[model samples]
Target: MRILMGIFVLAIYGGITFYLGWNLRTWLLAIQQFRWPIAYWIGLYAISFGYFIGKLHPLLTPFSIVGSYWMFFLQYGLILCVIANLLIAFTPLTTKLVGTWVISVLIVLLIVGTYFAYSPVIRNATIEIDKPGEDMRVVVASDFHLGVLSGKGHLEKFVQLSNEKNPDLVLLPGDIVDDSPKRFINKGMGDVMQQLQATYGVYGVPGNHEYYGNEMKQFREAMEKANVQILMDETILVGERFYLTGREDLTNKNRLPLSKLKPEDNALPWFVMNHTPNDLDEPANLGVDFHVSGHTHKGQMWPNHLITERIFELDYGQRGKNDMHALVSSGFGFWGPPTRIGSRSELWVIDIQFAK
Candidate 1:
């Protein structure tokens, strides 16, 4: 079944690529006859399949990066192509005119999205927990996805922005490393992360990407060495005030449940970080005062967020039920392509006021 599904998906992807290439050929032919049909098809398909081809080996990372951008183009390009085709069919508009407009609009969208992806925004929220503690400024940044595309420069910006907030607690929900932590460790990104200034400490949990890499020991060691703690299905009391419970990414079926991972001192305000915000009721039912997560990337692109909004209850931003406040970040890094449409890279500076 899985093999069949994979084949079906590949077929659909190939069909789309072919359609897009054919339209491009038609558009170019309208302007002037092109002779390199074989080269054109080869380049089109190669760029389309760059990501998967590059994924087969680490040496082809440049191909992977180029392919990742193509994936985004494929997504929006398909939509624009369809719309342009429809306009050409229904209206008196010529293919050249419609195609010109479509390509121009697509280019603008990609440029804007790339701009938003690189520009990180700080989102703020305040929650008053009915627990005794000093006012805490917690900075939550998730989904850094530090790999070939999002390099150490992005981490430096994150550290700089996070330090400016002067957060009491720095909580990274997940996806700190992309598919593998190789580039992150090899490039010394962890050292940049260590510069994050938080009064309490910096803590994070594993995202599905971490499992994808299957290098938990290396990822954890790198993080710990940088003073960024990776909590795996465990609860810890910080400053003897609040309790932080970081659950293993849902990818791990053997991970402990929210009930089992409760802090020894449950009376303190309990904060839970589960990489994917699939199960909110579990923590809410367990009386967790705050729940933070990432993984949706808020769809990470235009109209993609619409799908994520349906899958998760609170896909992005803060929500509340009684005293429990939950926040799901859009994340600080891009996953595949460094493009963000209808969403911007964001980190939350949550101001927590504990009850007197």
Candidate 2:
């Protein structure tokens, strides 16, 4: 199975490299950057190799961080080039002109996209739930994906934003760290994590990427050192007013479901932390007061949000009926592009009232 997966990945990577190179072939030839065809081939191959590095981004560290931006440019640039060539399929205009236009536009978009990626805006939302008690302000955010590229600066900003909200409880759904939790510790994010001030404390779940590189041990250790509690299919009472149940991330098939993990004491307000928003019916059916999640990133980039829209009913916001409500965060941090074109990077400041 692993071998088959590897082959599948290789095939896709190869196809993308071939298509991008062919689409930009004329531009490559016209450029004096490479005096010889051999050098040109080397350069193209190096760029093409960026895709693989991106796939293994969690482990590649600082190099992958820089490579991620380039990969995004290459990805979009190729698509634009393909579209231009198709639009002018048989036109007499030289392909060079189309290529130049596409390249120029790609550069401009890259700058704009970078700015968008770094500047994540805070989103404020309020949802009401039954199970009477005192009002509570819960801050829920996820998909930080902090690693080589999305690093210290991003972490500092996120922590600051989360703290400034002054949420009673800070809930991290998943994908908190990218490559390795150790990276967070080594990169000073561990200290930042400790600075996240919440009366009820900060809680987290493990996302797929946390397990991607067999870094669960490191992840657990980081959480402990940072004073963040990781709840793997566990439930705990917070503030003696509500129950916070954090389920294992969707990545684990053996993970316990909401039915088993949710505290049977239905008197207290319940908040469920789930990484992926899929299977929302389960949480709703279980009578959860609020289900918080973040893996979707609301597609993160243009047209990508559309794909997520088709997949999740509550892809990027709040929705519920009666006693059950779900809040899906686009994410506090980001992945690949570090830019938010179609979607905004976000932290959800949830003002919760416990009135009957």
Question: Candidate 1, 2: how far from true, in Å?
Answer: 1.7
The 10 consecutive residues of candidate 1 with the worst lDDT sum are 261-270
lDDT of 2 by residue, 283-343 (tens): 8888888888888888877778778999987888888755788888988788776777777
CA RMSD of each candidate after superposition: 1.1, 2.4
**lDDT by residue (tens digit), candidate 1, 1-356:** 99999999999999999998988888889878666999999988999999888978888877898899998989998898889889999999998888889889988998999999999999989999988878989999999999988889988999999999899999999999987888888999878988889899999999999999899999998899889999998998888788899999989999998899877675789999999999888888879999999999999988998899899988999999666899999999989989999999988999999888
**Where does model 2 exceed 4 Å of error?**
1-5, 31-34, 51-63, 90-92
Off by over 4 Å in 1: none
Output the TM-score of candidate 1.
0.98
Clashing pairs in 1: none
In model 1, what is the error at residue 290, expressed in angstroms?
Answer: 0.9
